[model samples]
Structures are given as C-alpha cells and as structure tokens.
Target: MKSSRIQSFAAGVLIANSAPHLATAVTGRQHLTPLAGRGSGPKVNAVWAALNLVGGTLLLRASRRGGTERWDGDLIAFETGCLAFASWMAGSERWLRTNTARQE
Candidate 1:
C-alpha cells in the first residue's frame, strides 16, 4: 500500500515536472536542466521531457496495480505530489529572482 502510494506520488511529480520542459522544447526555448545544466537546447529538453514522461508512466502503471479498488486514495496522493512539485517550482522561481536581484 505504501509502495503504491509512493509510486503514485512520484509519478504525479514526474509527469507534472515534464510539462514545462516539453513546452519549452516545442517552442524552441532554451531551459536549464540538471542533465545538461544551463542553456540546454530544445533537443536536449525534448529528450529530457520524454524520459520524464516515460518514467512517470511506468510509475503510474506500477501504482495502478491495485486496479480500481483503491483508486481514490491513489488519486489523492498523486494530486498531492503534483501540488507539492508546483509549490516547489514556484518557490524556486521566487528564490532565484530574489538572489539575482540581490546580486545586481
């Protein structure tokens, strides 16, 4: 049960995380990534996005092994993870902006 919840949460986090990168890739925008670091190109972003999507899909499948029996709980956990990631991203952006402003 715990494993399933964890997997669902991770899947949600990864899936949500991939959306921006994929959008950047499609729009030909450069984005920083852990893999390639600063100024990563669209091609690299595309690949990174795909990897995240695949990983998330796999985790989702693993978590869904329980079928529809306990899907409500799984969905809640997944949404919570997504929300957590969103909060982190927002906070990171604010932190970066503040630090950048301070440095100038």
Candidate 2:
C-alpha cells in the first residue's frame, strides 16, 4: 500500500486506541494505559487520549483526500485489526493485574 493508505490505517487505529482513554477521562474515571502504568489518574489518561486524538487526526488529514472521503474495506480492516489487538492487550494486562492482586 502507499504511504497515504498506511497513514489512514494508522489514524484509524490511533482513534480506536484513544476511545477508552478519552471516555474514561471525560467521565472522570481511571484507565490503564502504558503511560498510566496500572492506574495513574484520570487527568493523565485524558492528556494521553488528547495526544492520541491529535496525532490520529493529523495522520488522517495527511492521508489521501485528507481523510474526508470514504475509506476502502482493506484500510478499514487494517485499522480495525490494530485497534482490536491493542485493546485486547490492554484488557489482558489489566486482567492479569487484577488476578494477581486477588491471589495476593
């Protein structure tokens, strides 16, 4: 794929990755992210989320047609896959922490 396509795909993944952090930040809840370590703080998550959103938007805008037009299936799938993988990893890490804490 071309660089524009790759950027578009990355933008999708970044936005997907930002969702939970953004939601938690807006709702004044804590979330686990790499920056947050385990449970840093709502504000921290918010900052991280905002950064993600900015980066994603920038990438999308740099893509073909400035990401305003509709995207193709392959690109969407690639983005979705990235999102799913990242989300799963985050959730799995949280789950492991919870289980470990429970056992302790």
Candidate 3:
C-alpha cells in the first residue's frame, strides 16, 4: 500500500510537470522548462515537453501496477506538494535571475 501510494504520488508529479511544458510547446512559445538550458528556444521547449510527456506516461503506468487501482489521500497530497514546488521553482527562476542581474 505504501509503495503504491508513493508511485501514485510520483505519477502525479510527472503529470503535473508535463502539462505546462506541453501547453507551452503546443502554443509555439519558448517557456522555461526543466530541460531548457540557457539558450532555450521554441524547438528546444517542444522537445523538452515531449520528454516530460513520455516520463509522465511511464510513471502513470508504473503507478497502476502492483495492485494500486484507486487514489488515496496521502498519494494526492504528495503529488500536489511536488507539483506545487515544481511550479514555484519554474516560475521563479527567470524572475530571480532577471532581478539579480539588474541589481548587479
């Protein structure tokens, strides 16, 4: 049960991480994704998004294995927590760098 819950939570994190990058890629925008290096562009972002989708799908499948068929509160909480942290970090990195650059 505990292992299943952990896998489910991990799946949630990957799914959440995938969504924004996919959206940005589909929209043909160059947004800051995890894989986007300093020279990020539309094509790079799109590739990054594809990787996220693949990873998320794999984790989702893994979560479904080992007799885990339903969602649990702990699973949900862990997923949500990871998603929120990822979002915050992604959103803040650029702003932080820009602000610090100006201050220098």
Maximum-TM-score candidate: 1
Q: In every candidate, how many clashes are there?
A: 0, 0, 0
The parts of candidate 3 lying over 4 Å away from their true place are: 34-36, 73-82, 90-104
Evaluated at residue 67, the lDDT of candidate 2 is 45
- Runs in model 2 with CA error above 4 Å? 65-70, 73-104
Instruction: Give the local distance difference test score of model 2.
Output: 0.71
Hey, what RMSD does candidate 2 come out at?
3.6
Q: lDDT of all predictions, in order shown?
A: 0.83, 0.71, 0.63
Better of 2 and 3 by TM-score: 2
The digit string of per-residue lDDT tens for model 1 on 1-103 reads 7888899899889988898789889998777778887778799899988998999999989998757766877898889888988788879877775212245
Which numbered prediction scores highest in lDDT against the true structure?
A: 1
lDDT of 3 by residue, 1-104 (tens): 66656665676676666665667667765566556555456677677767766776676566667553565564674577467757776677666762122454
Cα displacement (Å) at residue 99, model 2: 11
Q: Could you tell me the lDDT of residue 94 within candidate 2?
A: 79
Put the candidates in TM-score order, highest first: 1, 2, 3
lDDT (Cα, 0-100) at 66 in candidate 3: 56
Q: Report the C-alpha lDDT of model 2 over 44-103, residue by residue, as the tens digit.
A: 888888888898889777775534456775367557747775777578767765313345
Q: Estimate each model's TM-score.
A: 0.86, 0.67, 0.64
